[model samples]
Target: MKKDDNAFGVEEAADSPGFLLWQVTSLWQREIRKALEKYDLTHSQFVLLASTMWLMQQGEPVTQILLSAHSKIDPMTTSTVLRTLQTKGLLERKEHTTDTRAKTVALTTTGEKLARQAIKTVEQFDTDFFQALGSKLGDFNKKLRLLLQQ
Candidate 1:
């Protein structure tokens, strides 16, 4: 009997765009994870924290629901992450002045410091990652934006 060639031998996967995308995403995520590990934050935590910090800097009183919408995070997960950040003294949650029932989030000094450092790391990683595409990055980003618009 002939050996199952595709099963045992390395096959050309040029046609597997989904697989390729998955592989690339995995690699990028791994690199980010490695970088963020030093800051004692997971990727989701960093994203939420950074987003909160940035939005807060614009002098807007932002709520958890608003953060969820902006960060594309689920409410429950955002709540959980915010709690963790609070415990770390990185963020604070207080009653929304205008909305008696809602809570507003603010980044503490520590959180702001961490976000600043993490931002440098993330920016460097993004620059290096996207540099491979050179001028093609704009086109690639545009295409991705188009797809995401759907």
Candidate 2:
């Protein structure tokens, strides 16, 4: 094959945004896994737990569907995770007062405490992980939000 005859449009892998994003995301998730080890929570569990606590604080009844949407996790996965959390004694699933088809989720006392603690740890990890971007972090976040909007 010719020196320039490769499948990639970019001359180098480093120039591909998707590739870079994959690499960075992998590294970030690895560290987050380590950070959450003490809490005995996987990243998904922490996300759902924290999200449930946050939504509850807003005085809105948080249902499984709502939590799934908020966390960007699919309904099936959300259900499975919720079941796991319930089994772990971290959360409770109850019939919604108004919706017969929907079940509301709430963190138990232990779950709430663990969620708060894990959130602090994850937030600190994020701060440190993204600190290299420094002042550009806001712009980076905005760009990410824009991508999400797409």
Candidate 3:
């Protein structure tokens, strides 16, 4: 008998971790996009904004480079997103007190309110999405963390 040959390989497509991960990620993104819609923010916008606000809550000024690193967002993309956030009056980038070449970021009052609300919405979506794993979610999260570390 000829060896089974399929476009994705002999193994079933659903058995491929990469393919399953991609499908899961796409589905999660779609859900997050919908969850964020009421706030008039895109998933990327919410990530950058929420990350920035959370960082500032640590009592330190946040910069574009720092936010980029913390959020794992590219520097150029971070800059563009920051500009968009600024236009929405959600955040402000002011000159760093000690660094003339750097700008520190802060959330406006409106930004803080929206960020908190958005955070709640996103968190609920995450809980609902992962609830299927039940108690096994912790193990699944650890596996994801290990993969990220690699």
Best by TM-score, which number?
2
Regarding TM-score, does 2 or 3 come out ahead? 2
Order of candidate numbers by lDDT, starting with the best: 2, 3, 1
Number of colliding residue pairs in model 2: 0
Clashing pairs in 2: none
**Ranked candidates, highest TM-score first:** 2, 3, 1
How far does residue 80 in candidate 3 sit from its true spot (Å)? 0.4
Q: Candidate 1: global Cα-lDDT?
A: 0.90
Per-residue error for 114 in candidate 2, Å, reads 0.4
As for lDDT, the candidate ahead, 1 or 2, is 2
Off by over 4 Å in 3: 1-10
Better of 1 and 3 by TM-score: 3
lDDT of 1 at 102: 87
**Model 1 over residues 101-141: C-alpha lDDT tens digits?**
88999999999999999999999999998898999999998
Write one digit per residue (lDDT tens) for candidate 3, span 1-150. 344666666567788889899999999999899999999998878988899888998988899989998988898999899899999999999999999988898889999899999999999999999999999999999999899787
Name the runs in model 1 displaced over 4 angstroms.
1-13
